[model samples]
Target chain A: MIRFDNVTKRYAGGHEGVSEICLEVDAGELVFLTGHSGAGKTTLLKLLALIERPTRGQVLLNGRNVGRLPARAIPEHRRGLGMVFQDHKLLPDRTVFENVSLPLIIAGLGRREIARRVRAALDQVGLLSRESSRPDALSTGEQQRVGIARAVVGRPRLLIADEPTGNLDPDLSLEIMMLFRRLNGVGVTMLIATHDLALVQELGGRRVILEGGRVSGEQD
Target chain B: MRLWLTRHVQNCLAAMGRLVQRPAGSLLTIAVIGIALALPAGLNVLVRNGEVLAGGWESARDFSVYLKPGEELAQAATLAKSLSANSNVDDVEIISAEAALADFQQSGSFEGALTGLDNNPLPHTLVVRPRPEAPASELAELARELGKDTSVDQVRLDTEWVERLNAILEFVRRGIWLAAGLLAIAVVVIVGNTIRLDIENRRAEIEVAKLLGATDAFVRRPFLYTGFWYGLGGGLFALVVVLVGLAVLGGPVARLSALYGASFQLQGLAGSGALTVLGGGLVAGLVGAWFAVSQHLTAIQPKI
Candidate 1:
């Protein structure tokens, strides 16, 4: 569950990242955030991730005020929600398995347990065969799937992704979208930000559109 | 507990792997630390050898108490017995004036010159050997006490060389400690600089780890272990340097001592001294790594 009631974030140079925004999503829902460039989608996701705080009003997660969370508690909060970035953010020096195992490792799982969960998550992302292959050897879509596997390895209830398919071809993007649909079928709440309007139309999910740092419209 | 220990083991191995990835750089850093530590270690060993050689010469320090001319031989013998009873005095022997004159006549080429004299000019003397462990100050005190006797003319103690050697040794010991302190700071600095560069090179990896919800402590663990390895290697290498130095000097020293008609052996650091060197290196490495990690890790949060 999530709630953002009239939250505004302003940068130090007097640039408003998001202004007087209001949004909410019930549990077990998959929502797509779409807008043009500088539409404040990334800023909204950052507030949810606690990477940036709202300048005014409040951002809540399951009725808890995350805008008020202290710096020391940010790590634990981030760990509770899985995050996927547009660039995949995979360590190029490590193998795909090692990259995916990172979240479970941070959670301090035992070696056997970590191995088991990493294999299962990689299987879900169709990256099981490329476990020992380094990220540099993988294609763009596979790298993004590796990132998805890493985010979901710890079985977080809520997942937030920023431009997950921004680097993929149309066919690869549709494959990745199907992967998200499968995850949502398993009751993992998903909030994905993207500007891919065609994919949004094809997916036929609840959509929130942002324009100039404000929620301009919504479609069901 | 099991998971925590497992993570530590993983981090330690990971650190070792990273070091091995750049073997030349790691070994060079270790060697610098070894030589830096070896300077003080070698100096300490040499000082100890000097003390041993001085200790051999120290036992000969003694006192010569001269009785007044024409003093009775019997009174001189009684003075020797009383002086021997003091706790500080190890032994005392009285030499009668007649015996002294005869010995002087045989040892010197002045027998004919001495026979021309009507009477023996030598006075009864007591040879006093103080306890081996007695300090120079205590020896001086005993000599002063002997001079207070009515039959005693002059008390002469041969302790100048002993006092001078002790003072020199004290000065060298303090100098070595000062050098050791400054060099210790150098070791810490060397390790800190190494770790700082390591953090810089791994900036991207650190950012990814932090974004994956890795705590600062988790990011710091591997760097600390790398420091630990560097310190440990340097410590062992320093001990090796000292041992080899002692070995090279040992043969020439023994030959020199043989030329002097004395058999002296070169001594290296004892167990406790070696332990101190190793412990100092380890602590320095850990502290240096800690400073670098704390200063640099906080500045490297995920910027997205």
Candidate 2:
């Protein structure tokens, strides 16, 4: 579960990245966040990950105020959620398996279990056969799939994605959305930020739209 | 517990692999550290050998008490007997002026010049050997006490040169230690600069790791291990350099001491000394890595 109460983030030059946002997503819920390039979607997700603290108000994840979490506790708090970025964020030097196993490795999982879960997650993303291949060797779609596998390998309760299919073709984007659908059906909560309104409608999840760093509208 | 061990082991191996990947750069850094460490280590060996030479001289603490020019052999013999009765005086031998003159003429290279003197000008001398364990200060005190006697003109203790040699050796010992300390700081700076460069090179990887929930400790582990390996390699190389230096100088040093009628041999680093060298390397490496990581790691934030 995630909750935001009047959260605001302001940069040093007095530019408000996000301001006074009140929102919530319950357990096992799939939500879509839609906004333009500078609409502060990334900032909201960063707040959830505790990457940047809210300048005002509280961010609660699983009933814990993440905005007030101690600096030392940020990593532990982040470990409970999985994050995927638009750029795929996979270490180019490492193989698909290593990239996927990063989260599990961070959690200090045993080798056998990491291998098993990585295989299962890769299978779900349809990149299981590309485990030993480096990210540079994969297509844009395949690289995104590898990122997804990495996000889910640690079995985090919440999955957050910033433009998960930004670099993919329409067909690949649909395929990736279907993968998220399947994951949502299996009781994994997710918050996805995307500019593709058509895909957002097609996927048929609750949509929260942002405009100029504020929540403009929500559609059920 | 098992998980912690497994992660640390993997971190160490991964760190080693990184160093091996760039062998030339790593070896160059290690060589710099080794040369720095070897300077002091070599000096230490030299100081130890000097101590050995000085120790040999100190063991023979003998003094010569010369009688006044007009003093007779009977007075000198009587003083020798009295000195021999003292607890600190191990032995005393009376050498009359006639015997001293004859002995000097037999072996002295200036024998013809010395034989031209009108009369035997040498005074009766009492050779006093102090107790085996007597300190130099105590022997000087004895010599001073003998000089105050009515029959004695000059009291000479052989310990003066030995004392001066000891002082020089002590000064060298302190200099070596100071050099060692300064070089140790140099080692830390060298290792620190190397680690800082390493952290910069891996900046992207570290950001990604932190984004994926890796703690500062987890991200720090590999770099720290890298520093450790660098230090270890440098320490081993330093030992090799010092040993090789000793090997090259060993024969020459022995022969030089032999010319002085001493069978002195250079001693290499013992087991504990080697451990200390290695330990110093480890500490320097770890400290340098820690400083680099703490300074640079915090500046890099995952900009989501």
Model 2, position B188, has a per-residue lDDT of 90
Question: How far is B108's C-alpha from truth in model 1 (Å)?
Answer: 9.6
**Residue pairs that clash (backbone atoms under 3 angstroms), model 1:** none
lDDT of 1 by residue, B76-99 (tens): 989988887888888888888999
**lDDT of candidate 2 over B11-95, digit per residue (tens):** 8998889989989998999999998888888888888888877776654567788999989888987898888888888889888
How would you encode candidate 2's per-residue C-alpha lDDT over A66-102 as one tens digit per residue?
8988899988877888888999898999999999998
lDDT of 2 at B30: 95
For candidate 2, the chain B TM-score comes to 0.80
Docking class of 2: medium
